[model samples]
Target chain A: MNELPMSHHKHNDPLPETVLRVKALESLLVEKGLVDPAALDALIDTYETKVGPRNGARVVARAWADPAYRERLLSDASAAIAELGFSGRQGEDMVVLENTPQVHNMVVCTLCSCYPWPVLGLPPVWYKSAPYRARAVAEPRAVLEEFGCSLPEDVEVRVWDSTAEVRYLVLPMRPRGTDALNQAQLAELVTRDSMIGTALPRSP
Target chain B: MNGAHDLGGMHGFGAISPEPDEPVFHADWERRAFAITLAMGAYGRWNLDMSRYARERMEPAEYLRTSYYEHWIHGLQLLLIEQGLLSAAEIEARMQRIAAETDAGAES
Candidate 1:
């Protein structure tokens, strides 16, 4: 077996070493006719633009505007999300938990960084970090506080530990003073961290 | 077996420092690493679960020491070699050639 490329670099500079290794691998793969650079670009485009938190934001906005949709979203999140055309790997099994006036929901994958990629795109570094992963479930209140999201003492907090079989999306409660905002406008308030249950939607 | 990659609920890693206005790719190389990994993954030879397992299967020390994308490229290399797509000798030779070229460029 080949040794990991990480060991080859001794200097503190990691970015250039990683870049060089990736380039070497890419060139070899292309020369072998196993992969095309165009395919790489397409994959990047799909994640960066076509699929992302914006897709989840649209779903959240629609849910906030339509009580019926919200009901469906809560009842069967996977199907409800699919209704908006977001489904596939890493999202095969999804459960949408809602945050209400009385309770808040947070998500963490204790085993691996299994996330709903179709909606959230790539998981953030913090989301995959050891600090967040280990602490998110242990002290969720403190974690949220660190993210500048403080909750009422009366409200309850629930943490969901994601597994290989199921991933989760947190439907944060719509902020007040936004009843007049349309779905499109509401989407603007739905930040990625809010959907991840780390923070709340921005007030209008 | 549980590995370092399964870091949820553990401790001592450090504070969760959030970078304000962080870019999608911190460095140009990260973009290349991300894109190349995805491109190679498109072959459909291995599934996402397998990829995750590859990263998780590393030694605890190495896994904890390596960066995220480093883990990714490590797993990619391991998978490609295992799948008969590339050989260890070929990879070593390529790295040596790259090192030599870089040294030559620096000296000139």
Candidate 2:
């Protein structure tokens, strides 16, 4: 369907130059039959609605709830995550970092915004910014502090720079008093930033 | 490539600001840019890494100054031209035409 109508730009204020340029590109591509508008809409809807951190959260929750799944996730993350149907582009290779009492793990793409799109959907704006790409690997402790997540002195911070095809996902430690919560309920506590290692899961 | 995009360990970009409840696409144009890039990519003209390299090949100053989707659009434009799918002049002429139409609508 033609959900995106050009008439939306009929406002009093003019659209930005980049906006018009993208519009022009899309129109030209459609006219040439190089791209389908419906396919474009489908792609947009898939990321905007279908795939996201919720998928990652469910994976983490399963890892926390079932010891067998946890072991599987720890050993072969790509296969285990694919078991839950989260595998595609940007997720062909995955490494899951488990946060324990002694070690804290975080992920960053120092070269580019190469995130696990299948699990986390498109990366957040902050994750793609120059500061995050520059500082996440260098001063992870200071970066964590800015995120309001200050770990204890005893815990070692490990920063995983996603330079190659391997995408890292942080499996945050389970919070206390969540023993009675079901896997779905446990998934509710996992935040996107927690999976990215910038924050911790919400306490039960 | 050691382009402006390779920002690891570099300094002076300032603090990371996380927006609360950030929407998937900041604006309508952003959604279009993201989708168009993905759709054109399905044509098998170029792979993902090639597109990334194209974005990184952008002039350093402009690369750093632009927003995320701006980088994407720039990269898409580069790929379109490189693959001979669309010429630069065609894009520019279409942009000018759209701009003129907007101006005319505003005056009416």
> Compared with the true structure, what per-residue lDDT tens digits does model 1 show for residues A113-143?
7788888888776776666777888889988
Query: Lowest-lDDT window of 10 residues in candidate 2 chain A?
Result: A5-14
TM-score of chain A of 2: 0.90
- Winner by DockQ: 2
Instruction: Encode model 2's per-residue lDDT on A20-65: one tens digit a residue.
Output: 9999999899999999999999999999999999999999999999
Q: Which residue pairs show backbone clashes in model 2?
A: none
lDDT of 1 by residue, B1-108 (tens): 677777667756555666665555666666777887877777799988788888787778876666677878888988989999998788878877887898899999
Report per-prediction Cα RMSD to one decimal: 5.2, 6.6
Model 2, docking class: acceptable
When only the first chain is scored, the TM-scores of the models are 0.86, 0.90
